[model samples]
Target: MKLLIGNKCYSSWSLRAWLLMRAAGIAFTEELVPLDTPDFKETVFAAAPGSGGTVPVLVDGGIAVWETLAIVEYLHERFPESGIWPRDPAARAHARAAANEMHAGFTALRGACPMNLGKRFGPRDRGPGVARDVERLAALWGQARERFGAGGPFLYGAFCAADAMFAPVVTRLDTYGIAVDPLSRDYMQAVLAHPAFREWLTAALAEPAIVAQDEVDEPALVDLRKS
Candidate 1:
């Protein structure tokens, strides 16, 4: 398998897919392409197996999976014993729903708190849009942890697809110093403690490709504001 990813510091989608692959213990060759470069488009086009010009593209044997969720699903199907999703049908369905929600939703949070693993900033700079998004995310995390995190510290317990989907959000929260309750904080810590996440952070800190657009610093947080 070959996985094409973007800069580890800024490509949140690639982080999700990469974390999933690592959690599943799927050994695959990774190719990192710096984004926003003059040759980035052509590089992705040449590296990606399919028509889409996107990173986090997975080539499994002869098959090409473009979207992050699609790649994760493909991995789950190809390696059933990996337990990328949950074993129970209901739990699996919930996990997929959470992952899909993360894939399509949270535009405000994503736009405001773009991933920059090597940067840390204040929370006051997180404007209204980002503040609202953070509140919603905190609520979601609390719910997931209370409902399905009985078996482990992850969203669906045992680091399933749902946890992988939200791993980047954890990075965002940490990078921006977003305040959360104890449970959410614990969950975020679990994500940070993941070996793959540690590896990604190490690589991100070492990366030299810094996009000026993503270098904005978030304001520091002094206290948790009520939602």
Candidate 2:
């Protein structure tokens, strides 16, 4: 199996898929394709069946799979022992819901706070849409952790598809210095401490390409390092 990803610093979708592959102990070779390059479109088309300039395409047995959530589900189906999703059916349903919501929703927050792994940034002047999204995220995370996260620190005990889905949001909250509740903040810390996440962050810091528009200077990076 092989995974094609974009610049580690800027591509949230890539981060999600890559993190899942690592955390699940799925063995896959990684191919890093820098975004916005002239060959990226052609490269994406050649690599994945339906992807058009999209990052994080997984190639397995000569088959290509795009879409972060779909790739995660594929991994879960292909390697059940990998434990990509929760074991229980009800928990699995809730996880799927969270993953789906993370994949399709949160447009405002996404637009306002693009993930910059190496940088510490302050939150922007959030509009109504962004505010609502943050509130919804807090509620969802808090409720999930309260109900399902009994055995471990992740959303549903062990790190699963839902964690992969929202891994970018965790970065967004930290990078933008968005103040979430204690539950959400603690969850974010847990994500940051994941070994796979730290590995990803190290790679992101090593990238050379710069998306200038993505950089913003506002308040200040609030270090969330656990003391």
Candidate 3:
């Protein structure tokens, strides 16, 4: 298996997919491509199936999976014993719904927070859209923790697809220094303490490919430390 990712410092989708693969104990050769550069499109086009030039492309044997969710599904199918999704049908369905919601929704939070792992900033200057997204995220985390997190600290307990889907969101929250209640904070801690997440952060901290545009968009007093 070959995993093509973007710069670990800024590519949230790549982080999610890489964390999922690591959690599943799937060993693969990793290729990191710096995003938004002049050669980025050419590199991705050469490696990917089509001309989308997207990051987080997974090459499994002869097959290429592009989208993050699709790549995760492919991994789950290839390694059933890894338990990427739940065994129970109802739990699995709920997990899929949550993951899909994360994939398509939360535009406001994603746009405002933009995952820069361990970056810190004041929350006072956020927009209404960002505030609303934070509220919704906290509510969702509380509900999931109360319902399915009985077995462990993760959303679906034992770190399933749902948790993997929200791992980037955890990074966003931490990066922006968003404060939540006890439940959400605990969940965030679980995400931060995960070994795969730590590995990603370690690599991200070492990366020197600084996108000036991304850095300028963030708060001036922010710190990009591995939380």
Candidate 4:
């Protein structure tokens, strides 16, 4: 299998599927396409004909799956024993609901703070929309951890697809210095400390591309890519 991704520093959606597969120990090769490039659409089309020219396209054999959620579902179906979702019925249902919510909601925070692994900033009041989004996210994470996160630090105890879906949100919060409750903070730390996430971060720091739209107007506390 070949997973096509975008610049690790900026591609939050790409990070979701890539981290899910990598952290799950699913064997696959990766291809990185720098975002905002002239050839990006053409490249994606050639690799995944009907994929709507998106990153995180997973190509296995002759089949191509696009959209982060679609790719995740495909993996869950293909490798049921991989624990892509929780084994417990209730836990799995909760995980799916949270993951789908992440897929469709949280645009306010997402717009206010895009994920930029190469830089960090001091937190400030972004807006009421961002505040509401963060509040909702914290409440959701707390509920999941309280009920299902008994076996590990992740949302569903052990790292599962739900965690993968929120991995980039973890980065977004950390990068922008958004404060969270102790529980959510601990969960974010676990995600950052994951081996696969570390590998991805290292590569991200090494990437030379600077995508303008993904970058924020605020001054960075430090440029990790240079360090």
Candidate 2, TM-score vs. the true structure?
A: 0.93
RMSD of each: 4.7, 3.0, 1.9, 0.6
- 1-227 in candidate 1: lDDT tens per residue? 99889988789889999998898898999988888888877877775545578888887776778888888889888999998998878778877887888899888878887877776767556678888877877888787777777888887689877888999889888878788878888989999999988888787777777786876644433212111
> Per-residue lDDT tens digits of candidate 3, residues 112-177?
777776466776557888888889888877777777778888987889878889998888787777
Candidate 3, pairs of clashing residues: none
Q: CA lDDT of each candidate? A: 0.81, 0.87, 0.83, 0.95
Error of 2 at 100 (Å): 0.3
Worst 10-residue stretch by lDDT in candidate 3?
A: 218-227
Off by over 4 Å in 2: 217-227
- Name the Cα RMSD for model 1: 4.7
Specify the highest-TM-score model's number. Answer: 4
What is the Å distance of residue 146 in model 3 from its true position?
A: 1.6
Error of 2 at 171 (Å): 0.5
Q: Tell me the spans in candidate 3 whose CA falls farther than 4 Å from its real position.
A: 216-218, 225-227
Model 2 lDDT tens row, 56-110? 8999988899988789888988999888999989889999999999988999999
Would you list the rank order by TM-score, best first?
4, 3, 2, 1
Residue 97 lDDT in candidate 1: 81
Cα lDDT for residue 176, candidate 4 = 95
